[model samples]
Target: MTDLARVRAAAERLQGHVRRTPLLSSPFLDEIAGRRVLVKAECLQHTGSFKFRGAWAALTALDQGIGSRGVLAYSSGNHAQGVALAARMLGLPAVVVMPADAPRLKIDNTRALGAEVVLYDRATEDRDAIGAALAEARGLTLVPPFDHPEVIAGQGSTGLEIAEQAAERGVTAADVIVCCGGGGFASGIALALEGSGLRVRTAEPAGFDDMARSLASGQVERNAALSGSICDAIVTPQPGKLTLPILQRLAGPGLVVTDDEALRAVALAFQRLKVVAEPGGAVALAAVLFRPAEIKGDTVICTLSGGNVDAEVFQRALQRQAVND
Candidate 1:
């Protein structure tokens, strides 16, 4: 588990490198949900996701000479772009091993940031295996997406900001809703919110709710399938080894949202809050609106993980909403 002190230290280190994204509110959503809803707009963060904070924290923690040799990582998309951008900023070479099925914009933006890209089939190839071999051959440092202490602590910066921002708005307690993949985001925040009077919960796509089942079972569990869900970003095979313990200790029962619910949440966010939230990114808001029983506070803080959805997908969500109405 990432300690609050380590998270605070990460905040200090991320002073200039990371963006303090706004905590947005929608009276419309509040009226419907029957609570004040605060959306931490991480979609507006640099590289368009909260992943940048963790990537930078990991990079900065390594020995200085490692930067010259470079770093290698495996991500579906967000973390790859985050690491690519971080390495670019630090003047370090970056190579990302990405699944061939990752969103196109993410792959494009990562290369645009000057990192070498290695594409692999998620179902056939082991990404970690490829990344490790490449790192050894190229003499580059390895930065796993969510398992490292620094990475988890760095991701906790998101929760730290919410605590400060919510306090500024006179909200001392809120049910922090996070879109969970490998438990890093929710676990990190839960650690940061320790004793702060706020509780954290994770929202994941229906069939891919490994963390949710794991929390309920009191042990880590793997998902049955990973490719069928529309929420590509949050479909990990299982929770991380390091993140599971923290989540087990701090987070509540995992909330599960269907692909359609996430799509509806994406459309609602656009019509109500004017934010372009991807399906996986909008799952927390989906839980807030459709599964209110899981939430325990009068105020809810949601992390809009990213806004990297392709153009066609976003349009289809809006179209579905029009037909339903």
Candidate 2:
């Protein structure tokens, strides 16, 4: 279970290995939203995403015998990089199966981190099947992007930090908006903040808002199509089995924002906050900025979970803001 104790232990395990990214606030955002806002900039994390925490925690917790054969993982982007980096830290090799159409930078980063990259056709092949086959054939341990206990506990460390930091800032209660893909990050944080007076909410791409639908219906829901959005890092089909229950119990009804809204939020992050946010990472900020009235609190915390966007994509998102100006 991903409780406070597990989260704290993970935090202890992560002290020197990972950076404690700062919680930042902006006068510009506060003025626009008419409320106080804090952003947990996980985009600045090692491997340019927050997935590193879970990857490191999970890998390190395993037996040395398992670590010797290396590890296998399936991810479109961030999680692949995370696992590759974690494996490197532990002197283990890694193999990552990624979609053929995943962002070029993410693929390149995974390779640069020393993992062997295997590409699959997302439109035609099953990533899980491919990963399983690779693991079986090579005798590698498989680490899923989400849906694991150790991974969830590692992710919950973000919430533990947020709670303590918020308390230090005199925030007794707040709404925390986090980007949701397979629900690992969202549910982990939710579980960690269980008694801290902070409520978790999710933000996802409009057509791919399965977590939102699942939360409302109390059942798992799959996205009709994973394609057609720039948010490649968060195109998961449904909430994870282990993560959904926690989200249902602690998170607010999820919010959906358009790709355009997400792009604009990315632009705003660069212009105002001076942070790099990929489309998936910007969804939480998009929901908060574009639909401020719908959010429930005077004080809010939004997690910018990743920044591994391709240069061309980042250029295009920034150019849109220039055009609008």
Candidate 3:
């Protein structure tokens, strides 16, 4: 299981490999939230997402002889790119099983990072089955997106950074909002921030708010749709078995934001913070900006989880924001 000690160890492993993403704030964002808002720009991390931290941590933790055989993963985009890039850097082969409808930019980028890409249908195909078969046949290690202990530990390193950074700013108590898909990222942070005066809250796209519903019911809930929202990066069937209990124990009530709100956040992030945040990445920021009544205290921290958006999608977000302005 992932804990504070495991997270600390992962941080030590990731010290030189991972970039310590910045905790950014904008006066404009604070004005919108009616509070002080800080954005953790994980979109600036390697592969333009926080997944790189977990990927590197998981790969490096493996026995050298086992790692030499290569790695395999299934993701809509961000995790695939993270694993692919990490594998390339480590001189190991990678194979990614992705949804056929995933952003083309992400698919191309995965291949460019030297991973063999396998596309599957999100509606009919079982990604796990495909990945398992490939891994078994090729003797490849599976790098789970959110369920594994080491992966969660690696992701928790972000929470460590948040804790340190918030203290540096003289902010002791605040909500640490995260764009939660399968709960790994949020759960990891929750573990890291335990008793640190910073609490974690999950954010999800409105139609796909399984985490929010799951938190409310104290049991796992599944999303009805497989694909529809623009926030693909943080979309998953349900919270992970390993990650849910941690979240249920440590996280605050979950928050849900509409796709439009996410797009607005993406645009606003680009305009104000001068950072690019894909829709899924911006969901936590969207919750902070548009769901103010749900959040407590005068200060808030949220993550911009990834920036692997397609150019057309990014342009659309910017155009909509322009029209609204």
Candidate 4:
């Protein structure tokens, strides 16, 4: 499990670097779920995702000399933009290796932040291997998306913000839900909640339910089947080695929702809450809507982790919502 002290240190380290996003109460969501619901809008964060928190924390935690050497990373989208923006802020060059199928909007945003983009086929090429080789060849520091300790520590900052915000609002023991991909964000948030009164849970897509399975089996589980979902950002086949144990220890329970449900949540966020939530970001809300009994407490906080959906995907999600209605 991630140390609470380390998580707090990361929060302190990133004090001025990231936004302390708003925690807004949603009456509609509360009525639907039969509980008080607050949305932590990290979707409004820098680069339109919570990944910036971890990226900034990891990059800033490094030695000043390392920053001078530049940084390299492999991401499907969000983390790529996070690292790119963070590196640019620190005057460091960054190379992000992304899947060819990643959303064009994310790619354009990363490039706009002055980072080099290297595209690879997810089927035929191993992105991590390619990134590692490039890092070794260029003497660039490699920033693993969810596996690195610093990255997790950085992500914990979001949890810290949520905790403080909740406390300020007099919410003492709410259930905090976050969407999980490789479990970095969930683990980090749970670490931040350690010793606090709140409980933490992870929400994931049904197609990529590795964390949910791993929690149940008491061992790490890897899914070889690669399926597409609207929540592409949280489609990791396995939990990161560093984040899995932390999540298993801290997170309350794992919840899985279908792609249709995820898209519906996204639409609900946009229509009812007037918030732009990417499909991955909306999974936690979907969990609360679809499986309310599993989550205890009158108060619940769901982190809207990103808002980087492409126009095409967003339109499709809207269409799905119309059909469902």
Using all chains and alpha carbons, the TM-scores for the candidates as numbered come to 0.95, 0.95, 0.95, 0.95
Model 2 CA lDDT for position 176: 95
Q: For candidate 3, write residues 1-325 as lDDT tens digits.
A: 7899999999999998899999999999999999999999999999999999889889989999989999998875778888999999999999999889976777888899999999999899998899989999989999999999989999999999999999999998999999999988899899999988999999999989998999999988999997799998888999999999999999999999999999999999999999999999999999999999999999999999999888889999999899889
List the candidate 3 regions with Cα displacement exceeding 4 Å: 99-104, 119-126
Candidate 4 off by > 4 Å = 100-103, 121-126
| TM-score quality measure for candidate 1 | 0.95
- Point out where model 2 deviates above 4 Å: 100-104, 120-126
Q: Candidate 1 residues 1-325, lDDT tens each?
A: 3699988888788998899999998898888778889999898888888899999888888889876899998875788888999999999999988889877777788899989989998789987789889888989998888888989988999999999999999999778899999877888788889898778999999999999999999987999996798899888999999999998888878899999989988898899988889999999999998888768778888899998888998998999778866
In angstroms, give how far residue 81 of model 1 lies from its true place. 0.2
**Local accuracy of candidate 2 as per-residue lDDT tens digits, 38-122:** 9999999999889999998888888988888999988757888899998998899899998899777778888999899999997
Please provide, for model 4 over 125-214, each residue's C-alpha lDDT reduced to its tens digit, 9 standing for 90 to 100: 987789889888888898888988888988888888898899998997988989999988999999899888887889999878899899
Error of 4 at 45 (Å): 0.5
How far is each candidate from the true structure, as Cα RMSD in Å?
A: 1.6, 1.7, 1.6, 1.7
Candidate 2 yields a Cα-based lDDT of 0.89
Can you list the residue pairs that collide in candidate 1? Answer: none
Worst 10 residues of 2 by lDDT: 1-10
Minimum summed lDDT over a 10-residue window in model 1 is located at 101-110
